[model samples]
Target: MTETVFQEESEVESLLSPLRSFLKCSTPKEWVEEAKKEKNLPTLLRDHLICELKAAQSAMLLIRRYAVDEESGKALLNWLKPYEDFTYRLVGDWRKLADYSSFNKRMVPKSRRPYSQPLIDKMVLLIKEELHHFYQVLEIAEELGIKYDKITSSRYARSLLSHVRTYEPAALIDKLICGAYIEARSCERFAAVAPHLTAKLSTFYYSLLRSEARHYQDYLALAREISDNDISERIAYFGEIEKELIQSSDDDFKFHSGLPC
Candidate 1:
């Protein structure tokens, strides 16, 4: 019986390892390669750090708008206070900030009774992981001497957001759809940037691809969960909009920006 149990655990781990591998591509290898490059480490790490903060900011906005209510929202704001205060200075151990980004909240109500538990669970976990990844990126950035500067806004977010409808559930649904677009684009960009970077950065970006892929799926899942009608129509609508944004020209040289303009 013990032997059977051990075998089952091993089999499960083996299956899950691939999923994990798919998330960041080759994180360990990328890290090793970064050490070898030496000269490029600072730039690469800074880019990664900013990306991580952007990711956390994305998650923060999501919960702030959709998940948290009045009182808890204040708490949430306080939780992120440290990062907001010290994106550059590192007043304290940044890793400790990871705990503040979880799903626990007294003011936020649970998922709507008839909603998709699977989707909610998945998204909550995605939020947690993304925040953790943000910390890892920051730590790496510190190691390489990168300073976090005020974000000047990227065209990537605004481009997809322009398509959001100007009304209630439809508005909410469209935003969720936009979320899907962002996650999909992030996944695509991660794959695109991987080869151009050093082994460690490539590995880290590659590692993110899978989670980023699933994030789009999660957003899509929620969009469907909220609507009784088939969501294929909505998905198709967003896909067209997403494609336009991806294929267009943009001035920013950031991660998800359009053709180098």
Candidate 2:
């Protein structure tokens, strides 16, 4: 049985080969062991659901801030209203966030530049997928009898976010790179813990791996598309920062945290 599961894990790792190459480092063994503990699964799922919501919100921010005109900005807010309502106000049903209908057709961009539509398209898809994942996670939490209690932000994201550049295109590029790292790490963690989960949970996490992998790719692709110069140097720089965050000590035991101090 162990050998069979190991073989399955190997296959999953093979599927993540692109992410492995794109990321500067692997998730540490200590963190993997920490994540695999049965007791940690609820906290992991709770934080993971929050992470998904944040991911969608992050993408929406990019669209609203960088790409959308004022009218479209209001539409964007309308799109996000249900999710935020469920999350913050808890005034609406979670099913409200599950809708994926069309927004306004006139998503006028601030500029007619080549990268605008690509960013809008990619981020829109990401928002849809991440929101769906968030709802799915809510379902999982319900099944497992885990309440959606609040969790403190993990150091991993804040550590990288603190380094975002203050300029125009560079700021955008940095955000894209950061997005790629977060998605890649999430995919890595899902694989690391899936085998240790109950079959139902394991299947759900595995189902998400492919979409998360593509999200990283989409972010990377957009980064490369927007940059005039080669982004390798910037990619390498962010990779180092990400590696440091993962390799160093962390106090929190949330998803994507480093080995606990």
Candidate 3:
């Protein structure tokens, strides 16, 4: 009905086309039946809010660890200051007000950790997308009267980050690829959960949000761009790792877990 729908349809069809051929069965009938329920909205929204925060935190850690120098790390931290304050310190309404979200001062000296053109561009895109998602979650939380509470990091993020390499470019590329897995999985889950949510939230999740999809692709592209050879091995490497993390049980359930734990 909307351009967003058309775009998502095309992208999803392209991305999932290969997987579709392996599927002999359609979506389970139980899912369609459950889609008619009403309470799925608030329940999913609560999980989504936590997921949004975890996503942003994931990107933040990657950039802070690998993408920047000391000064740039401070700058990145400064960039996330308001969000950290809001989420941890309990700031004002972010939906109606963007207090300090300008990226005009993105400073990275050319001499220090000179980023490849593609890597810089893709990381910038991811940074933007993650921050925007953070804002959207804050808005939804505000509207729904959900009290934001401070919780320790969830196991999902910890597990994903644990697989990231601990060197330089390898670390950077692997982290980016890991980010891709997370975004791709999130996109998949949003699609999976959307059909069962309420009309409004379902529309919101399915709306013309350009960034999340970009995030998945952007991270993957950066990984390939930096790799010396074909990226499939590493891609498959992380995919297996990510799938295991998502498909297993855990003590905590956040944005990027396998199943309900």
Candidate 4:
């Protein structure tokens, strides 16, 4: 490898190390092997496109539910409308989506909630980046001659979310921690599969590492900020759940799926 290549690899490892330690386990070799297969590329990209949109939608929900005022919430919905239409209704030109990823609306946080601004700030940026990534994944799929098709979601996110507490504040905090695990796992999988993909795809995946790493941190920081008490025990509790979900066998094999059975 050239000096530049070596330096890039070094940077990639530097980014992944803390993520590896943050999660209870790495992506299983079996899942990586399955994800890198040629037959799985279309499925992988399709699921990835949806995952990106879902991540954006999830962040949008956080802003709407916990922080933003009514008009801001409506603006957030409008911001995502085109992307949602394309994903669910198949009603728009995917090529035109790049222009829609931005949101210029002024978001007013709910009064008297000190944490509202930070929550809105982090999730709004996350929503933008995730929507942009959704477009990029679509662009890559088009470049590869892979047509977009809807696929059933993996059980991963639902299962993690099933454990969320039902009460206020605690529920929100749990969801944020869940967000952290989800983002961390996504970053880990991107690194695990990048090396096995085509050069162009590898480069794209590698480019996402920094943003994804920061996203997980953002989620964790917000979780800490929102809670009055220490959440270390809760963080560890979810880590074990996330680890099991990654290591267990599954018939389904989407982007965030567990080991392929």
Clashes found in each candidate (C-alpha, N, C closer than 3 A): 11, 0, 1, 0
What lDDT does model 1 reach? 0.60
* Cα lDDT over the full model 4: 0.94
Task: Give me the runs in candidate 4 sitting further than 4 Å from their true place.
Answer: none
- Model 4, 84-198: lDDT tens per residue? 8988888889999988877889999999899999999999999989998999999999999999877899999999999999998999999999999999999999999999999
- Tell me the spans in candidate 1 whose CA falls farther than 4 Å from its real position: 1-51, 58-60, 88-113, 116-120
Among these predictions, the greatest lDDT belongs to: 4
C-alpha lDDT values of all predictions: 0.60, 0.86, 0.61, 0.94
Q: In terms of TM-score, which candidate is strongest?
A: 4
Our model 1 lands, by Cα RMSD against the true structure, at: 7.3
Residue pair clashes in candidate 4: none
List residue ranges in candidate 3 displaced over 4 A: 1-47, 64-70, 91-97, 112-114
- Model 4 TM-score on a 0 to 1 scale: 0.98
Per-residue alpha-carbon lDDT of candidate 3 for residues 1-261, written as tens digits (9 for 90 to 100)? 999789868975665453333222233333333433444344445566656655666666666665555776677677777776666667755553365565665646334554544454566556666677667766765676765666555566567678878776787787777777666656655666666665655666655234566677777777776677787777777766766675565555444444443
lDDT accuracy of residue 27 in candidate 4: 89
Q: Summarize candidate 1's per-residue lDDT along 1-261 as a digit string, tens digits.
A: 699768754754443453343332222333334434556455445555555565656655655666655675576567556766666555766667766666575445446634434433554577567767777777656664666554445676676678778875677678777777677666655654566665666667766766777777777778887776786777677676665555566554455544444
Which pairs of residues collide in model 2? Answer: none
lDDT of 3 at 211: 57
Q: Is 2 or 4 the stronger prediction by TM-score?
A: 4
